[model samples]
Target: MERTLPKPKGIVIFGFLLPGILINLFIIVIPLILAIYFSLYKFTGGIMGDFVGLSNYAQLVKDGKFWNSFKNNLVITGLSIVGQLGFAFVLAIVLQSKWVKFREFHRTVIFLPVVLPAVVVGFVWTLMYNKDYGILNKLLSSIGLSSWIQPWLDDPGIVLYSVTAPIIWQFIGLYLIIFMSAIQNISSEIYEVAEIDGATGLRKAIYITLPMLADTIKVALMLCIAGNMKIFDNIFVMTGGGPGDSSTVMAQYAYNVSFGQFRLGYGSAVSIGMIILSLLLVLVIRRLMGGTNR
Candidate 1:
């Protein structure tokens, strides 16, 4: 006699997931497919009646402006990730210190910037960096350091780094929160044991706390990398990729190609390039971080 098998529960599970699947396909998959399809054609003034094959990609390789924007993005990403993570880690350590009074107040103050809108942050920084009447120049002049003042967003040499400082400042609080949460999750008993063993404050922090926070560090680094890679709003609002393309990043480049220049096909190519670069960086981060730990 043949035995009858039970109906699999996968059908019910799939039915539960079907709506989400369809939504993702419509929202993400369809647009991605359209972008790839459009990347092979030439769009003139928002019209894409002509097919250009690989010419657009070839043009990107030879485009000096595109490469310059690409390099600017690299610099911005590098500075933002390093500066944000370093500052956040230091802030986390400070907040976790038992000797620090009013820890809650300090944390609240530090995290205020993270909740502020990006456009607002950009405008505030733009005013602060204004050459003549800006507070930064005023402070420098007050200290009799007048010779050090320069155009913050106008100089091509320092514009990219200057714009990055505001972006880093805005997000540092979020990363600090992440690190502090991770630090709190660590068992106090471990600290007690270390202290009983005559461990100094620095020794306990270096050997116990830092090592225990490795997983958190990895997560924070990944976040910083992804966030910096897609930086657009701050650069757009502050510099507008101006001062001779001094602070243009990848997203801005793509925006210029698609909307500014009305070359949707080439813009799609640039977007695809950015996507690929971001993916590669994510993979590199995973490898460097040992593929995540529980």
Candidate 2:
């Protein structure tokens, strides 16, 4: 008698995938739905209160803090893109040249910051920026430029820019690696041909490298924008969103609203608004990139 082996059933296949799907729904989807629901009501002591019906959103429009936080995010995003991508691109090109010596050592030193923990970087920089006993002030004093030293984290006017420094310093290595790898994948023959045709230096970069690097640059820009949008750890560690919330970004503002001041409903609305804004901005940016596509 011939015996046939049992076949795997559709139920078994679904059973194998069900756990992950359910867990994702439980962890991500449920909270998202709850946030949207809570955005419509005023959260009270241990419970949601009467329906607010977009009052929270209206409050967002009228709130000066909300607008300030948004403006800070834009400034941070713009400056971050320029700082990170500009340095990374230059480093990638320079380091790729045969004339550069100890290339591996330079790469290691530069990329070292990328591997360091963000929390540690933040705290270290915070200490370095301390006005009374900080290295920064000490250096200025030694050079007889003592008047140049200001309370880095305490000053409202320049604190936001100061907060951005560590962020820009830390991420350049990551984008450098990415841009370098993209540069490498472009066949060497094209570059050689360009050189033979008297196209070198900035001509080769502007006409050849830039056109070929369109996609990679777009990815880098998107990552930079998204990261700046959700930035928290460094600012939180250094400033605690303080100096009168001068350095507050959207994420920090959401946390302060939700937990610090106990305004859960308004916080949820802010979060929802942030998500919508992020999505819209990304779409707009991506569309712009497409229009300039080579």
Candidate 3:
């Protein structure tokens, strides 16, 4: 038997949600509508030019640099799923173990980077990736791995990965915290029962913990996709899509086109493209993961 509570009156519910609804309308919905409207015209230099219709979008379909940036974004998203979510899950498991000491201290230390500004993180990593005075090269040289040291930010081949490293490092702690909270919500009796059944820690985690964390993992994946799709600040400060636009992502590409090149209309189209692609990716992920629709 279960008790049922009365649903709130419609007006009361609307009143309670009015502020948030208004804020989102002003901040997100309105701007998005404007971007879409601008995307259909030839807007340049703060002036509306010829009505381009779908020409900008047609151009976008054939834009090599835009596609390249899209590829980079996919790479970053994949790396984030593997690096941030994967590492965080492992670390969270370790922290939850009985033998791990000073768990709180470790949690706090890991999460410290999450509080720092993205620009600051980018600047710090940029200095570290310097070929000449950078500590990375120095450390490699000291350890007799001199041959392994190549330009982290200069080479187009590895610049994408190099920029991605900081993004992963900065956000791992956030996912770790999320995983920790999810793990805590699992029943202690489940672990106890598993132990009684002679299940090892690894086996228990695989069979029990993983199954229970499916929803959390789904949410984390969604967050990773959404966040990386619009990632700008870190890459902006670190590489500025340099080495000849080798490491650019969609957001940066959009920014460069809009403000940097004064192609506001095309930039808006790029932005709309980003939103569509992001939504598509999220849908694919949801479908693949057997989403909450059931």
Local accuracy by lDDT, each model: 0.87, 0.89, 0.94
Off by over 4 Å in 2: 1-27, 291-294
List the candidate numbers ranked by lDDT, top first. Answer: 3, 2, 1
User: Which model scores highest in TM-score?
Assistant: 3
Per-residue accuracy of model 2 over 1-294 as CA lDDT, tens digit each: 999989989999899999999999999899999999998899944866989898999998788897788888888888899999999988988898878999889888889898998899999999999999999999999999989999999999999999999999999999999998999999999999999999967787889888798889999998998888888889989998879979998889999999999989999998888887777788899998783444
Instruction: Write candidate 3's Cα lDDT for 30-142 as tens digits.
Output: 99999999999999865678898999999999999999999999999999889999999999999999999999999999999989999999999999989999999999999
Candidate 1: segments with Cα more than 4 A from true spot: 1-23, 45-47
In Å, residue 102's CA in model 2 sits off its true spot by: 3.5
Q: TM-scores across all candidates?
A: 0.89, 0.88, 0.94
* Candidate 1 lDDT by residue in tens digits, 108-197: 888899999889999999999999899998999999999989899999888988899998898888998898999899999999999999
Instruction: Provide the lowest-lDDT 10-residue window in model 3.
Output: 285-294
Candidate 3: list runs displaced more than 4 Å.
1-13
**If candidate 3 were superposed on the true structure by all CA atoms, what would the RMSD be?**
2.6
For candidate 1, give the lDDT: 0.87
